[model samples]
Target: MVALNMTVDSQTGERAVRFNIDALVIAGWAGRNREAMEHHIAELEALGIARPKATPTFYRVSPSRLNSDPVVQATGENSSGEAELVLIAADGDLFVALGSDHTDRKVEAYGVTVSKQMCDKPVADRVWPFSEVADHWDSLILRSYVIEDGERVLYQEGSVDGLLDPRDLIKRYTGTDTLADGTAMFCGTLPAIGGVRSFTTFEAEVEDPKLSRTISFRYDIAILEDVG
Candidate 1:
């Protein structure tokens, strides 16, 4: 289990907990915009998947695949990163964190779920209580930057409202209103600025304009030589 140094509350007292994660669920095609969803569907069609009937598709991943390290290794050179808003459920409480739903692009053509299993998912160590940001949730923004030939350029940016809310996504996935404790879900991402492309380094964050705080994380990619 991955233990998080979480902040429960600050105004009342310095309440913290070591949140344990037992499941990692990836929520795909979670866009609230039908146009954006069609755009993503067209993009994924180029990768070999047909149009999906559901607004949000749930993919279960091994909890052991989650990591907090700032670096991850993948086979060959086709892995790409998609910045997502992650939901962490711990002991009946919900929290939010930033995450990269890093996946193997080459393997994606074969199967999205199988491709999801090909890489380790990385998340920020810091998190915000869902209660604290629930009111101003739509104001939160998600952005990602990637290093291309030594320069950091914006890759993806949009408001969190672009995707389905945590409550709806949780209910859709779990068949309930609340996510069970020890469950972590990676909410889907927004479209890239230009287009999707692989990079050596990726940085992403979730910015809370109302609170004036951000939860961000950066990680380097190591492309191991393909033996085949």
Candidate 2:
């Protein structure tokens, strides 16, 4: 089990909490806009990944993959990070944070679930209470950037309106509107601006326009030598 120390940002104020997460779920094909979701599926299909059998598919990986560190290592150079909104249940309350569903592209072509397990999942250190921003949730924005050749380029950007509502997604995945404590879910991602590919450093953020607040994190990817 991995314990994550996260900060909660609410109207009342901010507090720190540590949770020994028991479950980690990555939700896929969860775009509320069917056209946009299909577009992302096509992006992966072009890379030889298969289509998911159902909409908003839930993938369970090890809780140990949950990481809030500034650095992550992945074997080979075929993995990349996609911006996502993570729902974390803690202290009997649900909070939302920014996440990067860092995945391995090569293994994904043959084994989607296994690919999701092959790398560390990066998460921001802080989160907003679900109820605090529930009224303005749709206005939240998700954006990511990748540093290539010392130049930062926009990777993915979109409003949360493009994806399924957090409550709705939770209900579909768990048969209930509530997420249990110690569980964290990566809700979904937007289509890459250029395309899905590898990067040495990835930075992502979730912004609440109405509240003028944002949660962001950056992680450098170190590719280890493949010795076989």
Candidate 3:
């Protein structure tokens, strides 16, 4: 299984979000076509998109490298080999950081869940209500997806959920007015299928002002047949 832990800023340090990811689905894909998968990974590296030396690894795409390369864009459509690379090249400009991983097992495929910890606070407090704080959190989550693979999406279906607003949490912990309106922040995560393409959608809901909630959903479905 693909295990992930997320901590949201709380008055007492940070709290973890509860979720599960099936590793079998990923492993099945890898097992069925390891060579094709490796070739696709090679294409990614050739374009400067680095991967971890181990399984269940995380990766990041530098903004500087992505903006300055042309070959990177040209290689985005080489079948499943270029799925992750295409997503990064298309969406990497918006994020300060990106994280991804894979596993070796076989099971049902659901989706990914991303949690947050308030590393920094906004400039002011009481300026933006709890609902607005939740909205800001939603915006940051939407901006975090940098991969734009036409075939494979970083997220599956109903993957993103349980976003906690740090406004009150930051204020209580820091004892200062840190979360103000229009304050900039970064948060969220993306799960990617190395070779295939997938479709995705984002959504949110504020159940309570005191406790905020948001969910970013992604779905995988066949869009077209063979065309080259």
Candidate 4:
């Protein structure tokens, strides 16, 4: 199990709670926009994957990579990053945070499952209790930035409304009313503003306008030489 020390703050004092992650589910092609979804599928196809079926796909990875560390190590330089909404089920309570589903694009072409296992996923330290944000969930915004060649650029920006509802995704994955405790799912992401690109550092945030608060995190990437 992956142990994560996450912080929660409010009228009460801030506390660092150790949570054990039992599963990591990465949801793919979950955009609500058909054109955008097609765009992503075409992106994957360009990398040599066959045409995708007309349904959302879920890839399960080892919980050990569901990390909060501010740095990630990659085996090569071909991987790109994207921001996504993350759902965490801990001790029978659900929480939401911002995260990056960093993937090895080259390896993904061969097998999405194996590619997902090649890199560690990074997530924000602070999270909101799902119940607190459930009423205003649609108003939440998800965004991401990438540091390319010493320049920081806005890689992605969109509303959570652009994706399917969390409950619906959970239902599709678990075939139940709620996710099992210790499960963390990285909900789908929006289309990149320009195109998918590799980065030296990745940053992302989840902004709740109604509550006037945001949860953000950044991580640097270390590309290891592929000697194979």
Candidate 5:
């Protein structure tokens, strides 16, 4: 396991603090066999093996039990490229995990959403349908960092502005929407030594010369630590 030191900067310089993270062990049983894992997973309609009532008795394998494999190819182009691959277990089950590398620090999970502007007309007021118009608007990125000791929560919030680089691919992918006037938003939360959780919201916009209006966009992020 690796310990991380997070730093915050002020007009003067930088201040740093150490965070202690205990190594977590996750264990879980795969499907009956490697070939049956997917079939059983599909039959159970479960995402991964986290569902409680799912069949095939899947379990969460610990980090120590995780096998090291070669890096997979990147998924989408731009700042937010991702890779998906399978982990083969000698015992007969297949474990799946997704890898997203967007910064110097390692991230366990993330989410993204995109939305567009709304339009009003004499006939009817409507918003851009993402399925119909698929281009427009800018993206916003939200990220999470583990805060240890809870020394400067309020001060850290003010310092978050400088922690991110807008041009990074990971930032772009997670923040941009595919649809026009699309509003993209992402929220990520990292617990004191647990898996990171993320959520996204998207909106679409409609364009028309007759009734054009400016849209207001906003983004908010919240982080909570010490979750078991």
Candidate 6:
């Protein structure tokens, strides 16, 4: 079991909580807008990745890959990060956080599930109660930045409108509206700003315009040579 030392951004105040996660699900091809989702699929196909057999596919990964640190290591530079909203179910309560579904593009062509498990998934330490943002959920936005030539560039920016509603996504995954206990799901991501590319430092965040709050995190990438 992977224990995440997370913080609850409750209305009262921020409180510490240790969430022991046993299952980590990454939802792919989950854009609510079929047009936008197809744009992403075609984008990947341009790079030799085949389309998913079905939309909103759920890929199961080891819970241990969920990481909270500010530094992540990749075997090479053939990987990039995608901004995503994260859902966590713990102690009978559901909370929402921001995360990056950093993936190995090279491995993805052959096997996406294996590629997902190849890198550490970075998530913010703080989260908000699902109830707090549930009402104005569509007003929320997901964005990401990539460091290129020592300049931070907007890699992706979009409203959650492009993605599936949290409830709908959860139902599709577990045959229910609520997530099982200790489950953390990466809800899916927006397409890239310019195009999909690798970076040395990747940052991601989620903004709730209604609540006037945001949760974010960044990680430096360490590229190690592949030993064969």
Off by over 4 Å in 4: 10-13
Provide C-alpha RMSD values for all models, in order. Answer: 1.8, 0.9, 16.8, 1.5, 23.1, 0.8
The lDDT, on a scale of 0 to 1, for candidate 5 is 0.21
Which is superior by lDDT, 3 or 4?
Answer: 4
Off by over 4 Å in 1: 5-16
Better of 1 and 2 by lDDT: 2
On the 0 to 100 scale, the lDDT of residue 182 in model 4 is: 88
Q: What TM-score would every model get versus the actual structure?
A: 0.93, 0.98, 0.22, 0.94, 0.17, 0.98
lDDT of each: 0.85, 0.92, 0.24, 0.84, 0.21, 0.91
Best by TM-score: 6
- Note the clash tally of each candidate: 0, 0, 17, 0, 25, 0
Instruction: Count clashing residue pairs in model 1.
Output: 0
Task: Report the C-alpha lDDT of model 5 over 53-152, residue by residue, as the tens digit.
Answer: 4322212222221111222122122112111111111122211111121211111112111100000000011122222111221221222232225421
As for lDDT, the candidate ahead, 3 or 5, is 3
- Higher-scoring candidate on TM-score, 1 or 6: 6
- List pairs with backbone clashes in candidate 1: none
Candidate 3 lDDT by residue in tens digits, 90-146: 111211111222110111011111101100011100012223334434343322222
lDDT of 3 at 97: 15
Q: What is the TM-score ranking, best to worst?
A: 6, 2, 4, 1, 3, 5
**What tens digits encode model 4's per-residue C-alpha lDDT throughout 118-200?**
88889888888888888878789988998877888898887888787888899999999799988899999987877776788
Q: Candidate 4: minimum summed lDDT over ten consecutive residues — where?
A: 8-17
Global CA lDDT computed for model 1: 0.85
lDDT per residue for candidate 2 within 1-228, as digits (tens), equals: 789898888878999988779999999999999999999999999899999999988999999998888899999999999999999888788888888999999999999999999999999999888888889888999999999999999999989898999899989988987889889999899999978989999999989989888899999999997775
